[model samples]
Target chain A: MFYFILDILGTIAFAISGVMVAMDKKLDVFGVFIVAFVTAVGGGTLRDVLIGQTPLFWLKDLTYIVTIIGAVIVAVVFRSRMSYFKRSLLLFDTLGIGLYTLVGVEKGLAVGLSPIMCVALGTITACFGGVTRDILCNEIPVIFRREIYATACILGGFGFFILRQLPLEETYSYATAILIIIVIRLLAVKFKLALPNIYKST
Target chain B: MFYFILDILGTIAFAISGVMVAMDKKLDVFGVFIVAFVTAVGGGTLRDVLIGQTPLFWLKDLTYIVTIIGAVIVAVVFRSRMSYFKRSLLLFDTLGIGLYTLVGVEKGLAVGLSPIMCVALGTITACFGGVTRDILCNEIPVIFRREIYATACILGGFGFFILRQLPLEETYSYATAILIIIVIRLLAVKFKLALPNIYKST
Candidate 1:
């Protein structure tokens, strides 16, 4: 039940963020909805597809689809107040990546992937929605270029594994791992940390 | 046997195109290989996933992976004379889309999708590897912005259905569909056919 609520909130956050990005592109109404839909579901869809999970998560459960639509509509309707919710939105987005990371890691474990691959899958689930959004909007993905987003997920994944080796319960390890990701991301943004410039000075 | 040959040829062409694009960006060796691999197999991978085909086409068959590696190596080795092979490359790429479009359509049909959705799937297969390539390379996909690529696949899909209704053999319809896509694409390029400018003057 807790995970389910977080998933819905994450879906809503992703959908709203997607709307914000699409609006920046001045896309048509249909274009905006499509972008929002893809943004909210693209990561999970890709993860499911990669693992051979057929019918897809969203297709099986209408919750994600309905949540995204509602979120998009609300965001679009309250466009003028977006800036006021920016911080809140950021919080929700951070929570999203945190929960999504665990969801992916668990899925990878179910498939019996190596620990490293599981971490990679977790990061993909957390970050690749934004990757898809950037691709659709014709820009380098923020994570690829500068953000500490995937790095936070990776570190959290390591934490998850480390905690699993301890005497802690699985729930404790899971929640602690999520908290680690959230803290890392929040602190990274708060301190304005970024990846080193990969391209040499022109 | 014929389909297998066409599939290999299509894989080679797509891989070569990926290498060419990655080369233009001056990416590193690993990056170039990744782009090429994705370009060669990404479409079919996506098609299989959507239809619930597990293990992916490339995973099930080592042929595509081997073929893409070979194609990329050759393209990179002969990079200095790339312009000289531009026309031959173009022809090969056209053949690729023609074949890939049918491949996707057949997959969709196998899963009992309607003709229209199957056409959409076919176009996705024919064109989205380039989309993935462009996204990775940090640019708008050429097809989404400027090419007649997906349009050719779509028109050919219509031709495929029409040919099927003529009491022709399945082989004849299939061959005719591929031919339609190739001919339309060649003509479009030869005549500089393009979707009308969607973006107005800034």
Candidate 2:
């Protein structure tokens, strides 16, 4: 139940971000729809493919597709009121990052991947879709450049692992993971935090 | 030995196609290199993942990376001369489609996939990267709108399947596949052929 709610929230966040990015490119409705679909579903699709899941995730869940369409409709209809939504984007995005991290971690565990592999998968699930979206939009991914994006995911996965090891219930562990990710992301944004780039001028 | 030669030729064709697409985007030298790398190897990577091949194609053969880098250098140094090269892009692209189709079919057959799935994989191998490139560049996929792109690949795959049942050797079978794809594509271009859109006006 928690996972389902978080998943939808994450989808909404990614959809809005995608719509915003398409707007930057001055794309039309179809273009916006494509971007939104890609942003919301791209990471999970990649993860599923890597895990050799057949038919892919969206094929299994109609709700995800419907949510993205809903997001695009909402964005388009509320274009005049977009400015008011700007301040809320960060909060929504943080919520998304946390939820998505948990999803990746849980999926990785379900597949019996090692803790290290699970963490990597969690990070990939949280960040790679945005990376793909930015790459397709002809820009470097913001997660790669700023805001401690993958780091937040890693911490969230660790939180899940630690909480699971304790005497806490499954819901408590899951909530802790999401909270850890969301709080870390929010703080990073509030404090203007970033990871050091691996590539530097020689 | 013929498959080896055809593979190299196909890589070169793919590399050139990637460079030409990058040129269309007016990307800088590094941008062209990255785009070339992605374009030439993206489909193969996806294939490997779907087939449960670990570590991926380019990761196994570093030669693919070297080939793309070499193509990028040739493209950058001859940017002005690349205009003349555009005339050959279609031919190279067609050759690439044919060769990749053969590779996809052979790989799928090796993995014991159904003939229908093999044909689909062949089409994916031939056109998925270009679709990806167009999507990233904020345009509708050329494969989606263009005249008979995947159709040519399907035809080539069918040619391979038929030739395999004949008295011909594997090399001839492969050559027949390539010839079928190239001829069909060239004729399609010459005749201005197209598929009818399924979505009619509302």
Candidate 3:
């Protein structure tokens, strides 16, 4: 039940990011919807495919599509009002990353991947959609260039795995993972932290 | 032998397109190579995943990566001279589309998809990388707005299926499909053809 709620929340948060980019580009309605849908579901779809899950999640369930459309409508209607809540969007995006990272790691572990691969999957699931969205928007993925994006997810994934080994409650473990990720990410952003660029020549 | 030759040709042509785009964006060596590799194989990767092919093509055959790197290096070194061959890029792009469409249709049929689905897959395989490239470049996908882009692939797929039912040789059938696609696309471009924009408000 917690996973389900967080999944939907993450999807909504992702959709908002996509919609903002689309609006920034002055994309038409169809374009907006396309961007939003892809942003919301792209990571999960790639993860599922790599894990040999067929038909994909959105294809099987319409709720995701509905939620994306709902987000789009809200964005469209509240375009001006939503501008005032830019910080709130950041909060949701950060929270979504944490929630998605946990779910993705759990899914990877459920499929019997090694802990390393599970962490990789978790990070990919949290970041790849935004990567695709940024690529589609003709921008460098902020996650790729920014500090503590993938790193935060990896840390949180490890945190979840470690907590699972303890005698703690599931909710507590989940919340701990989310909190760890969110705190790290917020601090990174606030401090203007960045990973050193690998290719210094360019 | 034909499939292998066509595949290599398509890879080279697609690699050139990627290099050109990267150059236009003033990307460094790594960025150029990344774009070139994705452009060369992105469509096929998407198709393979959709069809449940494991490990992905590049993972199975590292040569594809080597080939794209070679193409990118050549383009970078000859960037000024290659700009003189703008018409050649058009020709190669068309040829790549023709070859990719045929390969995609064959793969779809091999996997037991319906004829319509096969044609859809063919069109997707031929144009999706370019679509991705354009989107990443902050432009609309030519396939979505161009009247004859994906249409040519669909027609070619249909031609292949139809010709196979006749007494034509395999080479003849394949050549016929390629010719049909190339001719249709070139004529459409020459005539400035485009799909009707469905954006009522925009």
After superposition on all CA atoms, what RMSD does each candidate show versus the true structure? 6.9, 7.9, 7.2
lDDT of 2 by residue, B1-202 (tens): 8656666666666777667777788877776777777777777766767677777878888888887777778877887787786657667677778888888888888877766667767877887777666655556555545467778888889878888899988988988888999999889888988764321111
Q: For model 1 chain B, where is the 10-residue window of minimal lDDT?
A: B193-202
lDDT, candidate 2, residue B108?
Answer: 80
lDDT of 3 by residue, A1-202 (tens): 8668777878988998898877776555555666787788888878888898864566546688789889988877787677687888878889889988877888898999998899889888898898878777667887778567889999998988899899999889889998999999999889988788888577
lDDT of 1 by residue, A1-202 (tens): 9988988888888898888877776665544655687788888878887887875666445577668879988888788778899998899999999999999999999999998989988988988898888779876777898888999999999899999999989999999999999999999999999988766776
In the range B65-146, model 1's lDDT, one tens digit per residue, is: 8898889889999989988988988998999999999988887778777676677679879887987898789875666555
Best candidate, lDDT: 1
Measured against the native two-chain assembly using Cα atoms, what DockQ does each of the candidate structures obtain, in the order listed? 0.16, 0.08, 0.11
Error of 2 at B129 (Å): 2.0
Report the C-alpha lDDT of model 2 over A1-202, residue by residue, as the tens digit: 8667767888988988888776675554555665687788888877888787754556445687789989988987786677688768777778887877777888899999988888788888878878877776668777767668789899889878888889989988988888988888888878989887676665
Candidate 1, after superposition: displacement of residue B176 in Å?
1.8
Off by over 4 Å in 1: A1-44, A47-52, A56-131, A140-202, B200-202
* Candidate 2 residue pairs that clash: A136-B136
Q: What is the lDDT of residue A84 in candidate 1?
A: 90
Query: Which model, 1 or 3, shows the larger TM-score?
Result: 1
Give the top-scoring candidate (TM-score).
1
Candidates' chain A TM-scores = 0.97, 0.93, 0.92
